[model samples]
Structures are given as C-alpha cells and as structure tokens.
Target: VDQGHEVHVAYQTSGNIAVHDWDALRYAEFMLEFSEQHGDISEVEQKLYRKVIKFLRNKKSSDADLPEVRSIKGLIRRGEARAGARFTGLDDNHIHFLDMPFYETGRTRKKPLGEADIQVVADLMQKVKPHQVYAAGDLADPHGTHRVCLDAIFGAYKWLEKESWIKDCWLWLYRGAWHEWAIHEIEMAVPMSPQQLRRKRQAIFMHQSQKDRPPFPGSDNREFWQRAEDRNRDTANTYRALGLAEYEAMEAFVRWKG
Candidate 1:
C-alpha cells in the first residue's frame, strides 16, 4: 500500500476443522433439529446423525471447541497464504485475513452472505482504495466452499461498488484448489523458477496440516501439495505440449468478469 500496490486475500471459511468438528457439529445439530421439528427423517439426515455420533465418540478423548478448531484451521490457511504471497512478492501486511463469521459455528451449515462479512471486506477495500482485488472463485468446488466464498467476495465488492468505492478497484477471481486458469486464458502468468518453486513449496508448507490433510469433503484423500504440484506441473506440461516453453511451475490467473 505504501509503495502504491494494495492487495488482499479473503478466505471463504475457517477451513482448519471444516471437515472434522464443523461438519460433525453440523451433523449433530441438524439431527437434533430434524428429530424435533420434522416428521419425515430423510436418509441424509439419519446418515448425518450417525456421523455426528461417531464424531462425538471421537471427541470424547479430545478437547475441540468449534471456534478454536476453526481458528486453528484459519491460522494454518492464513500462514500458508502469507508465505505463498511472500514467495510471490506480496508483503505480509498487504494480506488481510478475514476469518468470516458465519463459518464459526460448530454446526455444519454456514450462514448466508450476511452484512457482517461484506461490511468488513468492503471497509478494507474502501480504506485501501486499491486498484485491484484478487479473490478465489471456484464456484464448482465440490466442498461448496468455493461457492460460499465467492459469494461473500462478490457480495463485498458489489456492496463497495454500490457505495461508490469500487471505481478505483478491479476485482480478479482465481480458481481455488481444484483448478487454475489455462495459459492462453491467463491475463497474468507468474512463473516460478526452480528456486521460486522451492520457495513456493516452502510457502505451501506454512499451511501445515493443509499440506497433508486438506479438508476434503469426503473420503477421497490427497494432500494439497499433491493436488497443487500435479496441477502446476500439468499446467506447465500442457503449455509445453502446446509448444510453449516449459517452466518448473507457474501460478496463473484470469481477469474476472462481473
């Protein structure tokens, strides 16, 4: 910001225990609510109930508050993002980690895009008066996080725009864990040399647990590194396959359209 570039990172959720306690609590809460209010208990509800019970049994030996778990996950994600940004040249202060509220529930279902989330983001954008805002927009993300997160970012940007704070800033959306922008489609391709790749990996390492056990919604288990490396190499290789010069790894981004 001091040097004229202002950037921000908006995470969609407290992803740390997103899968464990968050989902588990959601399972428990839903079962309790459904069993009390509704007459027909669908298989989905019953299934979730059973899962919640299992989680409780598991938690019997541990201490895990919903917010605490979410916070831990948030910190891991925040640290990794900061490290990645540092490796890529964005400063630590440039990043604003908004640990959005609706996600704090130990329950499974998160709140809709509320004023609280949008206001905080909008205020930041307004204060910075940034020329650009980069966000994750993986609406097709299987975990539903991509969708929820994008909703919040879009909501915030739109709110800022309505308040006339958006005239100076352009919002850019990057796909989340599942995908990256194709080379031909990329408006910006931040290439990583071997040294940079090492740095990027170190940055990714800051994510700690996410590097190993990302909050996969279901049983398909693969580390974030495996996914990211495969995606990065495949992207570079694809470019090579298409006759472009190959690089060790690359971070690609597409300019988002409203």
Candidate 2:
C-alpha cells in the first residue's frame, strides 16, 4: 500500500475452530454485559446467550461446537482480522473474508478441498486482478489450514492461468512459524530497519485474540509475534553470514512459478 499499489487481503477461513471455548464464553459474557449496560438487552439476546452457555457447559472435548458458538467464534476472528488489516493501513473495504466452505466444518479436522473452495478463490483473484499474490508457504502447519488454503490458491490459479490478467500476476510464498525459506529458495529478501521491525511487531499485536494464551500455540510455545521476530532475525543473520549487509530483520519470499 505504501508503494501506491492497491492491496486487498482475503482471509480464506473464519478460523472458528481455533478459538478456545474459554475465549468464546468470555466474549459471549461480555456481549451479555454490554447489552445490559445499554439498557437494551433484548429477550432474544438473553435467550441466545443462555442457550450458548448451556451448550458450552455440556460440551465434551470431542463434541463439535454449537452452530451459534461457531458463529460467535467466527465473528470474533473476523473482528481480529479486520483490526489487524486496519493496523497495517488497509481500509475495511479492502479486507475480505472468503470463509471457504471446506474450512467451515466447526471442527479441527476440515473437509477435503472442494471445487466450491477453488471457485471462491478464483472469483476473488479474478475480481481483484492483483499484480502480486502472497500466500503462506507453510505446508507443515500441524492444524493443516495453511496447506488447505495453499491448495485452494493453486487450484484457483489453474482456472485463471489462461486469463490475461494472470500473465502479469506473480505469486510469492512466505514461510510461517513452522520454518523459514531456505537461502537458496529465497528470491526476495526485504530488509527491515529497527523501527520497521518494531512496527511489524506492533501490527502483529493487533490480533489480541491470538496473544497471551492462544488456543493453539503449537510446539514453540512462544507468542506469534515472538516467533515472527525470531524467524525474521534469523533470516537476516543468515544473509549477513553470507557477506550481505546486516539488517535488523528480513522478510524472505520465493516467487512461485505456478
């Protein structure tokens, strides 16, 4: 966006399943409190909260979340995504939630990638006609959401490869917490100054829901921002070791042929 490029962020999943029950319950409780404080607690709102609370109380570890619970969690994630986008200087209109069907199972185990999911991604890419597309290259994510989303993008590209806009479009992949791009695989190394790195950390902090005690902290146990900073600094160190200029941090990306 700073480069005068029109940038849009499309979140392909609601990420409802990753929301911990405790977080959902607290949010629900807050809503109940908010409605009461406003002196407009509708009977329907009260009833809905009652139902959600009851369902959660009896919910087993293996049981799927109630649809109402799932919706609340999804909204929570959407709110966080929008907040993160805004923190990065994006307007609300430029933020999109694709909510791909394959990821709406309300369970950790998602459905296989389907044609509908591909069409949703394809439609967005075609509509945006973006010159560059950046996607997560973390196929080793234990949750498997990253892999599923990457697959959808690949599938979408197959549908749009013949389109004229695609000829100008370039796809870039960035590694996630699981790993960083190898030095040989990195085609672009965006060096970040100290202030820029701090700004990046602040931007990441916008996702409050994922802070402190995220539902799935994975094996590293560090916060998302910590992991990001460590990975970036390590990438920069690697570059310096290779006799390149030292940077506070770096973001590495690989241009995807497909």
Tens-place lDDT per residue, model 2, 16-74, is 98788888888888888888899898899899998898788778998989899999999
In candidate 1, what are the lDDT values of residues 103-136, reduced to their tens digit? 6664445667688877777677677776777777
Against the true structure, candidate 1 has what lDDT?
0.64
lDDT of 1 at 242: 82
TM-score of 2: 0.96
Model 2: lDDT equals 0.90
Q: lDDT per model, in order?
A: 0.64, 0.90
Q: Ten-residue segment with the worst summed lDDT in candidate 1? A: 60-69
Tell me the number of clashing residue pairs for each predicted model. Answer: 3, 0
Which candidate number would show the highest lDDT if scored against the true structure?
A: 2
Error of 2 at 84 (Å): 0.9
Among all windows of 10 consecutive residues in model 2, the one with the lowest summed lDDT is: 208-217
Q: Runs in model 2 with CA error above 4 Å?
A: none
